[model samples]
Target: MTMANASNPFRGIRIGSASGAGLAGWQAETGRSPAVVHKHPVTYRCPLGHETTPVFADLAEEEIPEYWDCPRCGRAGSRRPGTQPGAVGPELYKSHLDYAKERRSPAEAEQVLAWALGQLRRSRGEEPAG
Candidate 1:
């Protein structure tokens, strides 16, 4: 095979070239820039029958966005009126008690509580009353 036909192995490659000369003045930042961001949920609806709630993070001094492009249809989506931003879903919360109620019957839970109280009483060297 001819020398020209033989691959140089380094073809189309430049080593140690400073192509990023424009960013010479840029400094590496330690820690976080724009630290402490707040989030808001904004809803976007497309004409193509697609809807989404996009949560956007806003910097401490920046304002939350009111609109976003629909990801499915690539159409402009405006924020719904009176809708709050950052997290989507009902605000109703379930505590540990609520979860326990869902997983156990009332009578079973009462039995478990009674057993726990008896164990505690025995550990403390006291007789548990019936």
Candidate 2:
């Protein structure tokens, strides 16, 4: 084995076509053609005035997305200039307990807490209070 093969066992193995002409020859022999795709460009502007236009493969007009992410600042960009993402500010943070309270009433929360305490007591081999 050569010094190169000693370092990498796969050094002797060859992968795909080394030349573009080989690929062209294979395509000619197979009689298969590449698929044709239609693409269009869509433009969006972020509130920070960053403009981004990306090519999209959309055969129909309805396939285009309403919003695209701004590549520059990573903000949500709007397809229309007037409907920028910053029109609505970021939502206020809500804790896990706040979300839980929204989903459950006070009585329901009390019942759940009591059940949880009962389960904990049972695991500890103690009788749960009524």
- Which candidate gets the maximum lDDT versus the true structure? 2
Per-residue lDDT of candidate 1, residues 16-111 (tens digit): 222353211112123222335568666676545578897777644247455555666555555664343345432334567878999999899999
Segments of candidate 2 deviating more than 4 angstroms: 1-23, 85-130
Q: Which residue runs does candidate 1 get wrong by more than 4 Å?
A: 1-91
lDDT, residue 120, model 2: 97
What are the Cα lDDT values of the candidates?
0.58, 0.73
Q: How accurate is candidate 2 locally (lDDT)?
A: 0.73
The TM-score that candidate 2 achieves is 0.46
Q: List the residue pairs that clash in candidate 2.
A: none
Q: Report the lDDT tens digits of candidate 2 across residue range 15-113.
A: 333335454334456756555567888999887899999998865777777778777876678788888545464333466898999999999999999
